[model samples]
Target chain A: MIILNQSKLNPSNIQPSEITSREVFENRRHFLKAAGFGLAAGSALLLSKQSQAAIAPVTFKANSRQKISGFSKTAYGAGEKLTQYEDVTTYNNYYEFGTGKSDPAIQATLFKPRPWTISIEGQVKKAKTISIEDLLKLAPLEERIYRMRCVEAWSMVIPWVGLPLASLVKWAEPTGNAKYIEFISESDPQSMPGVRSPILDWPYTEGLRMDEATNPLTLLAVGLYGEYLPNQNGAPVRLVTPWKYGFKGGKAIVKIRFVEKMPLTTWYKAGPSEYGFYANVNPNVDHPRWTQSSEKPIGAGLFGGRIKTKMFNGYSEQVAHMYTGMDLNRNF
Target chain B: MKKQHIVFVKAAIWLFALLPLARLIWLGVNDNLGANPIEFIEHSTGTWALVFLLITLGMTPIRLLTGQVWQIQLRRVLGLFMFFYACLHIITYVWLDFVFMWDELLIDVAKHPRILVGFAAFLLAIPLAATSNSYMIKRLKTNWKKLHQAVYLIAILAVVHFWMLVKKDLTEPIYYAVVLIVLLGIRVYFKYKPLSKSKVIKAM
Candidate 1:
């Protein structure tokens, strides 16, 4: 189980982890009804390591980090290495934590991310639910510089470390009829404070078309900035798409389903006219009451001049071909 | 001599009113507003607009309660200044958030209910501003009072705009809401009290 050290120390250098398999954590729920069950369960492992005075560090070496061939860092710390809890957990996109830019940072600290698994099903030929560890072992982790464009016209550049969804889906073996892939976030209201908010439907959900999911641009991120994922940024698993609006990247993910038809998405379902399934960051397509032609980099202040938006967040060379001969204005 | 003195005083008040906005523009240019500039600009303009609005709403009450006729003359000026700040608030969102994309801008306003409420408040103020001149007031006559009644609705919406954006920090918005309710309460109490037109004009 993945337990967090609330202190500022690096997970790898922190005290020894009270490691427990998913099987025991999930099955022993009834046993945890007793008093002091948490300390009692973890103390058994803690006593075994007598030499470790403080605690052995929790090491999260998911996979080797490979650099993608051609991508530029964003203006706001895109390619910069993220310090474990400081960078990854501090910056967040959860609006329910409070709409303030720092709401997610303050509220997401309570998230319990251990003992999570992702269920992969739908139109896949070989469908099975895999623990986060199994999914991490499926593909090699690679560092890809992704420019995240929010629907609100603010942008961020993040170097995400994860496997391409195409490689992982290949393992699941998507059926020939599968036309779309939908990702569901873990809906535990007990830990995720945002789930209790009325602003967005609980247990946030997002989806991408089969082609978009398989596109080289899509990544199932396990970490960013050379460390394990932060709780604010989806922790153990989440989706990362370079060409689309940031909302397409579902956070705190737990389920991945392949379907023959387009799946209903949270933003689209909440307000279809405002948020479309194809929320690609196209400067040409304007939001109903705002222009999408430009964006202010996050932390640039509200009145800062906008940086001109690109055709596909400057990823036209890699993704523009998908909309060949079709007018982006119409699709947008 | 008194007329000349009045002109000078009016000019000075106009300059003083413009100063706060000038400082905001300068701060925006220098990027000194702090992290999350959008929030800073939005809050600054929204608060200034509310201040000017409350001041406009207070003109009659201030004049009646304190017998200051000069306060009535400042009403139009304050109302316009409120409109000015509202314009800045809208402009900041258009330039910074929407990047001047009319379609997306329209869609965003449509999608976000809070923005729609704010837009309604701003739009209602526009007609009141346009009809503020003596020529329109004299032309409309009885309709002038009806036309300006929109300000009450605008005031309520302005409060709603403040309330929605403040996710958790209710202190600032709630304070404004209470002040608005009190101001509206005074208007309501006086509204039912029987009075003569000359006495009302003298009080204002």
Candidate 2:
């Protein structure tokens, strides 16, 4: 039979100095009942004192040297409730694992993200392949709570821990001719089962204009809610372009290439009429089959009500200038 | 059939027909509908609607092939259940999703072809559901058959709505489409073929 962790049940009484034997720990309640004390009192003793500690909200811990700096938590962070880490981790659209929203969480558990390497190549002056361990050391990670908007008209406020993508770009030293940056996700069918389906071209690809790639708001997230990124959320590393639709932030990234021309993104290649290359979160530009005027936050209760969608997902101040004269409807 | 047996069958039909809605309520009350409960509710109701529609359409073919007149008794129940689920699907969209905001809903219905098609299918189901009783069936006679035949068109529209709603996987809608085609094909074959004595007796 499986045993509940005793430490979790009695947080205060259990300590390193007094190591309880496994047999004693497992049979403590039986021993207590055998003794003169009433079972109710014995259970009360165990349950009362540490009840608060037992139910204390879990705080996620970051990796060593992964603590970020210079990120001031904004009003948006305070205004919007953070999506539960459980919900954020479990409900994902990582088609690499499978098409179902819950598929990634179950299927990606066996995925080995450690001993991973990401290649920075193409139009960069100094193209190099770096280990994930070394990649973590490249920049100080920061916690930025940003609104993630899906093209499917759902939204989530996520606390992401990562450094700016511009920092990585600077390290790569991109050539002036580099107009766009293409991101390639890990797509070996042996590792990612969803790749077996021809629903999308395998080895999912996404791209951003050089300026968008180098924008201050663009992040290369390795963690969420102050913890190491969950495998379903693209553990080790993933892209986070807050102003764009969530798909633009390709997960389980294995390659970042600086290109002279705009590369064909996977969604654009799959259905150009539905998914555009720019993919900026604009309320006015509806998807072919659905309206983008409003969104249902994932954890929001049934009929929890929708909030109106904003242009650039309410990051107009930061990203609107990038498309000063361009028509959002046309680009969308 | 014995009167008691018919009553027992009718009760069983009611219980079976109400199971999906009951399960939905249980899930809703227990908070077991997962993260996006609204989506779970919408998808469940919509899918059940399609299932009941398929079952209702299959009743005639099953009765004709098996010479089971009792199968016809369950048709009205299944047809009503389809309409009920379709109503729930629309209510969830209008009340929960759009919050009765007519302006936004109008714009949404105008812009999205899938929504328009789905709404059209639901609209078509309403008259059939209202006229399902013996009174209307007898009152309209042959015209009732003509009106109820709109179900074939509604089935196609429902399938198209499903096809348009999905993002990548076409497996589900394709499966539904195949079932609908086979059901329609059976009807077409029986309609066109010269009836043998055995065939006419079987259909009767």
* Top candidate when judged by TM-score against the true structure: 2
Regions of candidate 2 where Cα sits further than 4 Å from its true position: A1-78, B197-204
**How far is A66's C-alpha from truth in model 2 (Å)?**
12
- lDDT at position B72, candidate 2: 77
TM-score against truth, every candidate: 0.64, 0.86
lDDT tens digits, residue span B1-204, model 2: 677887888798789878988998999897677777888889989999999999999988886567777777778888888998999999999998888878778988999999999999998998999999999999999999999999999999999999999999899999999999999998887777776845775656
DockQ of candidate model 1:
0.22
User: Which has the greatest lDDT?
Assistant: 2
Residues A192-219 of candidate 2 have per-residue lDDT tens digits of: 7888889898789999999999888999
How accurate locally is residue B21 in candidate 1, as Cα lDDT from 0 to 100?
81
lDDT of each: 0.71, 0.80
Candidate 2 chain B: worst-modelled 10 consecutive residues by lDDT: B195-204
Which lDDT tens digits does candidate 1 get at residues A1-332? 22233342465545222233454444344333332346454445333422122211233323211112112122333444322333334456765454555667667666755667888888887788897767766765565667788776767666676778998889999888888888988766666666666667766789887777888878898776644566667777889887898888998888888888888998888778778888889876777544577776755445445678887888888787787887666666
